[model samples]
Target chain A: MEIKHEKIKTNLQKILPAKASGDKWDLHLYIAGQNPKAVTAFNNLKLICEEHLKGKYHIEVIDLLKNPQIAHDDHILAVPTLVRKLPLPERNIIGDLSNKERVLAGLGLVDHSELKLV
Target chain B: MKKKERPSHRNILPKSPTSIQGLDEITGGGLPKGRPTLICGGAGCGKTLFAMEFLVRGATLYNEPGVFISFEETEKELTANVASLGFDLDNLVEHKKIWLEHIHVERGEIEQSGEYDLEGLFIRIHLAIESVGAKRVVLDTIESLFAVLPNQLILRTELRRLFQWLKRKGVTTIVTAERGEGAFTRQGLEEYVSDCVILLDHRVNDQSSIRRLRIVKYRGSTHGTNEYPFLIDEDGFSVLPVTSLGLNYSSSHERISTGIPRLDTMLSGKGYFRSSTMLVSGTAGTGKTSIASQFAEAACKRGERVLFFTFEESPSQLMRNMLSIGIDLQPWVKKGLLQFHATRPTLYGLENHLTTSIKLINKFEPNIVIVDTINGFMVGENQTEVKTMLLRLVDFLKMKQLTAFFTSLTSETENLSIPDVDISSLIDTWLLVRDLEIGGERNRGLYVLKSRGMAHSNQIREFRLTNHGIELLDVYVGSEGVLTGSARLSQETKDDAEQLLRQQEIGTKQFGLERKRDAMEAQIVVLRSEFQAEEAEALKVITIEKARNERFTQDKIKMGKSRRGDVSIKTTGTKKKKYI
Candidate 1:
């Protein structure tokens, strides 16, 4: 069961788009400075959010250097913080965005089998 | 089109016989007859049982021959599965009352274009129905046709035509459909069963698997709308309806012993009435079986037959284990006062178990019946089936005026692992057992959850397994709370802590009150002393003023005396002249 579930998750990641269009939950990836790992993480998170959440998600790229005051107001203590400000139940995920399962759970749309771990 | 018969009018539709236990009551007798009723669910949701029970019950109980066409399971597997429920499918088959057929629809069976339509299925059904003169039929997973026929449009049209043809044939039918991920039926077969639709769902909630049945739609009949919980046991399927019975139910005013003397004393004088269903539920090893056995033994001793059903343990094992506590069931078994029927829960489908149980219940006519470890019976069955089975058992016991007792095992970790049969709502008496951990020890505890029409022990009693039988110890209401599994000798520690806290609160309040009273007392004393000094000073000042006035008067007299000698000589001449 575990191996099959993992394979489903991997397959899902392959066909997902980097950025979803016309999603209701618009999330901006805010980073202080851009590095190669940071760029890869942002692309990976975008791909996952697009595939699973599909039309219900939106990804935006934000450079904290240009808007330092906005980052401070939003309480962005970490460099890479994904902020969901549009939805009624506002939330934030702070990480390099590698763990797809955790991100899915944080978004409150994780599958029942996958949500158990979270 | 020609003048329709008033009795056969759609408005006066005949009731569909659910054949499963309490379902008939909820359905107001049963599903509509001569209509294609749909039963749909996901994999392992007990859709097959729902369909099979309807057909088998139609043949045996209702005296209506039936046909079963399975698209998934084989004839042997279906027979063997329901055998444990005491369905005796072999016997039913031998009697020619029921006809069973398994249809295979592999990927290779598909044909691009064919005029055959669903005629292949129609022929098989017709043959089976004609062979047994069946008035009812079941097609287990007609959706297998979808897998065999690639063209969805042709499949849909043929299915609609097939239902019309069956309706004309006037044989009541149940067509099973595989449920999709979130939808009610996998292929939305709900749209196809045009006349009636029922949904069967199986799920494991809180670690206990439950089966639920919902009447999606029942045309032209007064039916129950609630999602009734059901049980799939050896006998057959049972639907537990939450609705109330009619006002004309039997109400005999007689009480019987619960087999526990102390407990009986707490319940008014004796215990529940003769035919009352009693529920004994508790955490594992809370002595549920022991309590149930005691009830059985008591009835047997009174020369009444007792039927003991054990899903968790065998008859010999249960007898041997109970004997350790001095309950000799073997003597009664030999004398026909006691009968034991033990089997694994998976021995048959839920409906078969129910039917088998019904058969045993009828044949034995036991004064008392006990089902040990109801949780095991919940494995393949869903919640609806379990509830229905219990309801039927309770109703049957009440109808026969026989006492029935059941024990359910609750999960230790979860408060409600599975909706451990809510016998609480149906039974006349409910006994709750638990394992309490206090003072680092475990103790067995018993409490009455509820007892209808009788006063029961509300306090939790600590009990033990002694040489003779289970003994109810003194009510454990010491410094430490009631002990459940084992009692630790640390009551003094808890008592000391409670005493200290009580004393601290009392001391705080006493000190506050005494400080305020002492301040008031000191103020009163100071005011009294100051008033006394002022009074003495006022008296001294009055005395001094009086003395000064006397001295002043005396001085005035002396001054007048000194001046009077000179003035008297002058005034004497005037005074003498005035006197003359």
Candidate 2:
């Protein structure tokens, strides 16, 4: 098998942190075997991040099968557990990631206009 | 023609003194002065006893000789029945004070006829009344007339005429009629004896048979309209009007402890007011009897008399059981402070039980009374009668100013007694015992549902019966979820663990906060020192630049002076002085 290490490095390079000035952010999309809904959720979040953040974001899609221990350590009782491991303040959100707006807001992407009113 | 108010006269009628035990109170005095009071009821309702009692008491106690006419039982059988009551029927017969005549009417005695009269009955009754000079007369059971009559209309007419004749003769009489479903009497005797009418009923409430007497109406006489509980025992009949004993009769007002502080706090000040009616209802084995017995024991210890009526357990058995729990009733019995009357509900009837209870109450004058488990009173009765009996019983107790405790068994939480003679409503306090399942264990619990004119704890208090009598645990707050019998204590222990956990959480949070604050303070100190150093360096650089600028200015001035040549070689060219 002609496994090209360059190809993997190129992929890793695209995921590297672009700049340090903006809010540092990294998100993980957890999915099980290949299901249509899971695949849709991944595409939806990917498109949303590209359009909103452009070059200021990094995301990793973990299949869980490749790292089962990670799920156990997090006490993940269900499938598809999203974890944000870095960025000054870290957070986690769990689900199929069906609602993009909600996922973005949960990750502090949307401005808290309502809170300012209060 | 006022010309002669021919021998103005008045009817000197003999009053029917309402010989019923407690019925006189309800019916202001008694029945009409001279009238036939119809007594009708279903079979086994103490109807025969009511009629017989009126005649016997009238002849013996009041010295008003009477007559008894029975068409159902023989005179000898009637005599034997009242013998246990200490009534000398034979002596009354010899003295002609009471004439007992049995009219035999066989089913084959009827003859085909379109019209007939009760002339024979009228003749027999007149002769019997004349024979004894009887002021009171009782014709037991009018159904026998129907059994022998061939025409119904004629029987009705003759019955009406017979009542009128009795009224004319001025004899106070009691005529018993058989009760039919939805009908006052099988022969409709109420239509004729409209002046004074009463209905008797015997039923099983919660498995025990109870008898009740109701005064339908008494013209020109105020009577108790409510159905009163009556007991027919070896001593005849006694009625219980529990409500009549209210506040006018003075009570001790001395509070007695329930041996439980929390429960005492629930009661007025510390315990129930003297002469209060307390009702305890619960599922099977929920400690109703235990609570009642505790109250009884408390009364006996205070040197107050207590009477305990048990229909299910024998007196000895009750004493033995109570002894195991540290309640020594034997001492009270020896001192005559406590008396136990244990008998089967079916021994006589509700009327008998009522009579026996009244006799003991009147004779012993107990300060407190207890009826253990009232379910037995509902055995043979329908719901209505059971209610009436209980109301009368409670009223009587209240009137006597006696503290009474009654325990009832409810099958389900919704199995509430109806509002007929509702004992719960008549009582001043009500306690409910129930079984609760929590944390995989079944536990018995008790709570006060109602307490009138007093403050009471609304919490469910867990309790147990041990060698110490009754041990009441703390209230259940559900902090550690639900708790069952075995783990209720464990839940408390769990609650203690929670407190420790909370304390540890506080300690960890405090340590984290202190570390964060220390780091912040260190960063602030470092930043302050760096700022001071930078300020000193900037000040040195500005001083050096200022010195360099001053030297440049001095050189520029010198250059300008040289260009002008104002003092060029003044010492060598003094002679060549020129304005060049």
Number of the predicted model whose TM-score against the real structure is largest? 2
Q: Report how far off residue A69 is in candidate 2 (Å).
A: 99
The CA lDDT of each predicted structure is 0.72, 0.71
lDDT tens string, model 1, B1-580? 3466653665567876766778888777787889888888778777777777887788888898888888777789999987776777788888988888777555532223111234345555666777889888888888877776555776788788878888888889888888877776778777878677788878765455667888878888777888776777655677766543543457667777767787787677687777777888888888999999888888887788899899988889889999999888899999988999988887665545665776798899888888887775675435765776666667767777778788888888765445454556776788888777766777787778778887776777777777688787665465455544434335545667989999999999999999999999999999999999999999999999999977976675578688886553344357568559
Model 2: docking quality category: incorrect
Residue-level lDDT tens digits of model 2 in B479-523:
465465668777778778999999999999999999999999999
Please state the error at residue A79 of candidate 2 in Å.
99
Model 1 misplaced stretches (Cα beyond 4 Å): A1-118, B1-12, B44-49, B60-63, B67-134, B206-208, B231-236, B242-249, B255-272, B277-298, B307-330, B339-364, B369-400, B404-580
C-alpha positional error of residue B467 in candidate 2 after TM-score superposition, expressed in Å: 1.6
| TM per candidate | 0.49, 0.54
DockQ for every model, please: 0.00, 0.00
| Native interface contact recovery, all models | 0.00, 0.00
Cα lDDT for residue B525, candidate 1: 99
Residue B38 CA displacement from its true place in model 1, Å: 1.4
How many pairs of residues in model 2 come into backbone collision? 37
